[model samples]
Target: MSKKGKSRKKPRLPEEQDLDTFEFRPTGLNLKWTKDLITVFDGYRIHRCYDLTFIERAIGEGQMPRSFVDQWRFIRTILHRFAAVSPKIPGVMEKYKRRQVVRFVTLVLLTIAVPLMVATFVFSITAIAP
Candidate 1:
């Protein structure tokens, strides 16, 4: 008896919301969180680094593939959990900013180096022939 054939429905999954594309995109906070989460394991705790042990266990439990253990989704989940538990941390943004600066500098240096090398090669060739 309704005029509209179908009513619009809200998203059922929280993860599916606010996402514009189907492709994966882990937030900067999430990456940092994942980095922090790896410290919980004994091997990782001693090194203060991430290792394959937790991922291997998840794969053994059939939660994820052995190969996909280190995939973006796995890391993102850890990051999301980390974000929930520890939302605020001093100097986190600064670290990300530093990383960005380093990436930019490396790109600029490569750009300049390539052109300078090519120009030097051309100039040397012309000088030797004259």
Candidate 2:
């Protein structure tokens, strides 16, 4: 318990870290795509792009692919489709935003409800058991 026996550790700065261990390398295309995607979401007033559920909902209508490869393909397809068109077209952007909002809200409600239903079923069964 003596103060002399205690050692304080200092946090390491980014410059102090080893460069070889840093793995993230964003290519120009990747950076551009990220920027473009952010812009699209901003236009739609959707700011939860970092959320996994939001991303899945936005790209695949809340139905996520079973495998990583399929998920990547699905995402790439959606990104390409988004990049190919202008959301500024009259009525198109509004329709898309409305659809996305509905999908996201429905998915969120279902996510909350399914677990509650399962828990309620379990409790009911346990309560009825001798």
lDDT of 2: 0.55
Counted clashes in each candidate structure:
0, 0
Those runs of model 2 whose alpha carbons end farther than 4 Å from true positions after fitting are 1-88
| Candidate 1: tens digits of C-alpha lDDT, residues 1-130 | 6676777897443343333444433233345445544454333323334444664465568755343433444444444455544225677668868989999999999999999999999999999995
Candidate 1 clashes: the total is 0
RMSD of 1: 13.2
TM-score of 2: 0.35
Residue-wise lDDT of candidate 2 within 35-57, one digit each (tens)? 75566545534322333344446
lDDT of each: 0.55, 0.55
Off by over 4 Å in 1: 1-79, 83-87
Question: Once model 1 is optimally superposed onto the true structure by TM-score, how far is the C-alpha of residue 41 displaced, in angstroms?
Answer: 12
